[model samples]
Target: MIRVVILGAGNIAQHLYTVFTKSEAIQVVQVYNRSQKALQSFTNVATTTRLKELRDADVYIIAVADDAIASVANKLPFTNRLVVHTSGSASMHVLHKKNRRGVFYPLQTFTKGKEVDFSQIPLCLEAREKTDFKVLQQLADAIGSPSYKISSEQRRALHVSAVFVNNFSNHLYRIAHEICEANNVPFQILHPLIQETAHKITTLTPYMAQTGPAKRGDQKTIDDHLEKLDKDIHKEIYTLLTQSIAKTYGREKL
Candidate 1:
């Protein structure tokens, strides 16, 4: 069995630990964090607050915040052992040269206290060495997820695109929620539409599925949407994005 060590006790770390421990080909030998209290959920698995106490695992995965990754990686006592981080925005080089560095970024937003389906998440793998790349790919397969090899440059692009799709999309949801509250309409009314919008993209590209008054250059409706916005910033953002979408589809008038 491939012995594994997991760093951090956050949402992503917890999810990965749970999944890795269940894999037959892998065994979570130890879990380390600066605070022992954060490692509470890892019952039956060895836990430590000291880096030196971390055992001789085949691979060490740093699943902490982007800022804390380098600090943890730097403390590893071994050289040439596989070390990987689960960050989408952080570069693979952040890991100390004392160990082989790689990235096992799962391209999905993770929220604490909620369960995530690994099967739906795409694992982006990158390593300077081919052997390390295969190791990451094997790990993704062991966990029953799809894995893609991406360069730091391509990964950066994907990370930025993810911010647009996930972060910006969530903000749009919040805006819709507020609009519903102001109009005394239930937000649940938009649930079906939201699901359908996401479902449509599975079969149709966002460019092909694009719709609305903005795409059609309906100046009347565009003006009405902007006038309905309670906040000036929201109106500005909406207008900018609408204009961008219009330009993308060759509808320059919007």
Candidate 2:
């Protein structure tokens, strides 16, 4: 079995732990978190709050916040072992040089209490050594995840793109919900459109899938939207997005 130590109890950590446990080829030997309450769900495995008490394992996966990764890795009491992080943005170099460094970033947004199919999530792997990379790939394979060998630079670029698609897009959804609420309309009305738009990208490039008043350079429709928005911030956002879309479709003058 590929012994693994997960060093966090957050959303990604919990999800990973659950999936790893279901894989016979991978064993989550230990789960460490500074907060005892956070480690409560990981009752079946060995748990510790102290870095000095970490157990020997084939790999140590730091599933903590991006900012806290280096500090945690620097504090690890062991050295010359495979250490990896589950951060999409942070580089593998963030880990202390004391241990073999790698990145095991799963390019998907994880939420507590939400069960996601690990096999469908793309696993971005990076390691300083070839052997360490193989170990990460084996772990990914054990979990039935599609693994990709990516460099730190490529991973950084991918992370920025993720924010645009996932984070920024979610914020737009919230804005739409707010607009619907203000108009006394059900937010669920847009659910089908949202799903259709999401599925369209799977078969068509986003540029080709584009369709909207802005794409058609309908300034009157754009102005109506801006005027209908009650909040200045919402109007500003609408104008900015309209401009972006118009420029994308060669309707920049609109």
Candidate 3:
């Protein structure tokens, strides 16, 4: 069995802990956080607020924030064990070399109370050593997650793409919701379109899935949208995206 000690109590930490516990091949020996209060939810497993009291384990998964990763790894009392972080933007080198470093980035946005299917999340794995990479793969396999062997450089590129697809797109949804609220329209009315847009990418490339006034270079419709928007920020975003879509389709004006 692979023993893992998760070192944070945040969203990623909680989700990883939940999935790891449900796997028969992996055992969460202990959970460590800066304070005991956050560790309250991990009742069945051993937990500590102090690093010095950490138990020896096969893997130490540092599921903390990007800035705090090095601090936690540097403070660890042990060395040469497999140490990995659950960050997409941060490089694996962020983990102190005192321990073998790896990355276990799950390419999905995690929320505190949301329960996601572990099998649906892809695990982005990177390690300094080939053996360490295998260990991470084993952990991924235990959770039934599809694993990818991504180098740090490739992982960095992937992370940026993820931001564009996940983060930026989510922000657009927020903007749409705000517009809906201002117009006194039910946001749920747009839910089907949102779901269809997401599903279209499964069979068609985004470039091929394009369909809108901007894609058709309908300047009148574009102007109408800009004029309808009440906020300057929303107008700016609309214009920018319209320009982008037009440019993608080789349309000089929209």
Candidate 4:
């Protein structure tokens, strides 16, 4: 069995602890945080606020904030054990050199109280040693996740792409919601389009799936959209995205 200790109590940490405990091949020996209050969510397992009190486990998984990862790793009482962090952007080398470092980045947005299917989430793994990489892979498999061996450089690129696809896209949805609210239209009207757009990318490349007035070089429709927008920020965003789409399809003159 792969014994593990999670080193945070945030959304990602809680999700990981829940899934790890469910897997027969893995065991969550303990969970550590800066305080005992957050640790309360982790029931029936060992919990501690002291780094020196950490138990011996096959791996120590740091699921803390990106900035705090190094600080937590530096405080670990022992060295040379497998230490991994669940961060997409932070480099594995950020963990103190006192221990073997690896990354176990789950490439998905996690939210508190929302249950996720671990089988569909991509687990990006990186390590200096092949053996260490294998250990991460085993952990990923135990949780029914597909694991990818990615370098720190490649993981950084993935992180940026994730921001574009997930964060930026969500912000666009928020903008659309605001627009709908301002115009007295039900935001639910856009739900089908949103679902269809997401579903299309499954079988079609985003470039091929692209369809809109901007893609068709319909300047009149694009102009109508900009004119209908009430907020200057909304208009500006519309204009910028229209220009971007036009440029992508080689219709920059539009």
lDDT of each: 0.90, 0.94, 0.93, 0.94
Which tens-of-lDDT digit does each residue in 1-254 have in candidate 2? 99999999999999999999999999889999999998888968999999899988999999999999999999999889999999988999999999999999999998889899998999999999999999999999999999999988999999999999999999999999988888899999999999999999999999999999999988888888788889999888888888899999898897
lDDT of 3 by residue, 111-224 (tens): 999999999999999999899999999999999999999878888899899999999999999999998998899999999999999999999999999999999888888889
Overlapping backbone residue pairs in candidate 3 total 0
lDDT at residue 164 of model 2 (Cα atoms): 96
* lDDT by residue for model 1 (129-247), tens: 89888888888989889999887788999999999999999999999999899999999999999999999999999989989887888889889888989898889889998999889
Question: Across residues 128-236, which tens digit of lDDT does each residue of candidate 4 receive?
Answer: 8889899999999999999999989999999999999999999999999988898899999999999999999999999999999999999999888888888899888
lDDT of 3: 0.93
10 residues in a row with least lDDT, candidate 4: 222-231
lDDT value for model 1: 0.90
Return the lDDT, model 2, position 110. Answer: 88
Give the candidate order by descending lDDT. 4, 2, 3, 1
Mark the 10 consecutive residues where model 1 has the least summed lDDT. Answer: 245-254
Off by over 4 Å in 3: none
Residue pairs with clashing backbones, model 3: none
Candidate 4 Cα RMSD after full superposition onto the native fold (Å): 0.8
RMSD of each: 1.2, 0.8, 0.9, 0.8
The CA lDDT at 108 in model 1 is 87
